[model samples]
Target: MVGGYVRKSKAKGSSNVSYSVTCATCDEVNILSHREVGGLTLPLLHSSHLYRVHDVHRTSITATLLSHMFSQSQGRAVKQQLRFYSSANMSVNLEGNIFVTGTNRGIGLELVKQLAEKTGKEAHIYACCREPEGTSAEALRGLATQYPGKITIIRLDMSDEDSILTAVQAVSEQIQTAGLNLLINNAAINKPDSLAQLSATGKKDMMEVYETNVAGPFLLAKLFHTLLQTAAEGHTSEGDKMSCRRAAIINISTIISSIEKCPETFAQAKMYPYRTSKAALNMLTRCQAEDFKIQNILVTAIHPGWVRTDMGGEQAPLITQDSVHGMLNVISSLSNKDSGMLLDWQGEKIPW
Candidate 1:
């Protein structure tokens, strides 16, 4: 429960603020040497308290910085004040590259907004959509304008192999070698369908849905695998617990896709194509986790719940903000033990 930062006096004849943190375990002060004032959250060795560790330029997290940021309550939700502090303008040293799909609207847009709002200026975000300059991406454009270089909007079409390749190459160029820390396969599609609607064209509808929801994620993971691997290997310690601190791939999956729980959920809706494709996506998540774990990359599937969004009808109980808020927290706390599992926005495990 002990947390807060103090502003030290300005350096002689310098405009930059002199920032320091008193190690909670031993009051050993660590001065933040940066071009300007910024902050990062750190729990130093033998400390029961949380301290903010800030720097304008963050070299790396697992190398010489605070190896872990969790408090004693690792299993519990992070305190409200900490979350607020992170979302505030104060810089957090999450200096890594992140790529997200379907950035135009809905959950993808919310993810991009929250990521931009939460992480520090050091984090580079590539917001990918089918039409980066098209009319649909105006809000995304606004975000790019608002945050300046913090986010880069890239053109991506989940269903198209060539477009995905071009996006990968562009993103790889922007990020230094082995620096893609997070990849979120959040882009997806859903259309009206039922078993009764499964005519020849309905079958084609199923294939189309599969192309975007299942195949897109699969291809992205395959192409980005080595970059993700290199990022993980740079950590230099396999003992480091799996987190976004390590390279991570978060596949935005759904609860309706759970085969064991389908009987309980079937009465709600019967969108055949959407349901089947997500089921396939879940399998992809499991397969990726198995393949990537040894390389120190963390992969998992998250169900954002039936939120009130373009795809999730207005009648749904959850809102986009709350769902994304919980999801970001869950993602931050993931360890190797949780890899390959299906988890909810609150970090609760779901039956595959």
Candidate 2:
């Protein structure tokens, strides 16, 4: 199903009439032309087209059409009027405050970089990392400089609760009453451990991984809960007709976290610590999704795919740019229905 409306084109030419229809289901935007409807009025044509193509119809199509006709008859210009409905692409509101953790390198750095490029001044992105002066962190700092006020580099050590609180406070002061719109829990650590090597040393390594990958995100979400709730309230106040308008938390989990798809041979490869921590992180995502439903915050776990990072090494199938790009697309398309699901970079649901 799709809904469409006609608006006066702001383009230089008066004859330029642009009509946009977005699918109510997928939210994919389709730019329509008069040629496509062969002179039929846009509303009537679109109503019939949606019914025939998507089997979806809105009862207000007639009212909308009459209203548009009335405006034309009155010799008044119709400004852009929008009716909100849930759609995959429509869920992404880029003009909001977004925070990304572990922005020094790899996927985190790429995500910050791409987001800055995509949203420009429309978004305020807080890029957080442990060491602000490190080489990779310097690169992120350069991006912040390039984008100026759009990006702020905050010091955040995922293992340190005080550091996390400081970062949250910094974001709060910057965004003020606007609140935090999205939190990307991208900070994580991976340590390889085998069952055969299960000893005190291996246990310590596993605990460290758990602290960074699971506990850190859990605590960050807890500390930022109020900001997220405030953002949700602001979204609702906008009177967007969308069924759900919630702030979002994206946990950067991995496909390796899936216990259901784990093969015996792969499971014994001495990567137990990394796998177990991500699995725990996935569980945390599910718990947060259920717990935050009351506040209308959408929490999701996503696998960014095996990309060519320091962790993924040379033979990795995807590159950081491609992986981050896909992940952003998936993130932009998220609805409340997707909360708590373990999804891939491409937005496909993954096994538990």
What do the candidate models score in CA lDDT, each in turn?
0.73, 0.71
Instruction: Judging by lDDT against the true structure, name the best candidate.
Output: 1
In the range 97-214, model 1's lDDT, one tens digit per residue, is 8899998998889888888988876688899999888999999999999999899999999999999999999888877585788999999987653323444336678888999999
| Candidate 2 lDDT (Cα, 0 to 1) | 0.71
Which numbered prediction scores highest in TM-score against the true structure? 1
**Residue pairs that clash (backbone atoms under 3 angstroms), model 2:** none
Clashing pairs in 1: 40-53, 40-54
Model 1: residue 140 alpha-carbon error in angstroms:
0.4
Candidate 1 off by > 4 Å = 1-95, 193-201, 238-240
Query: Please, what is the TM-score per model?
Result: 0.73, 0.70
Q: Residue-wise lDDT of candidate 2 within 97-186, one digit each (tens)?
A: 898999999999988888888763567889999999887688898998998888889999999989988988888888888878889999
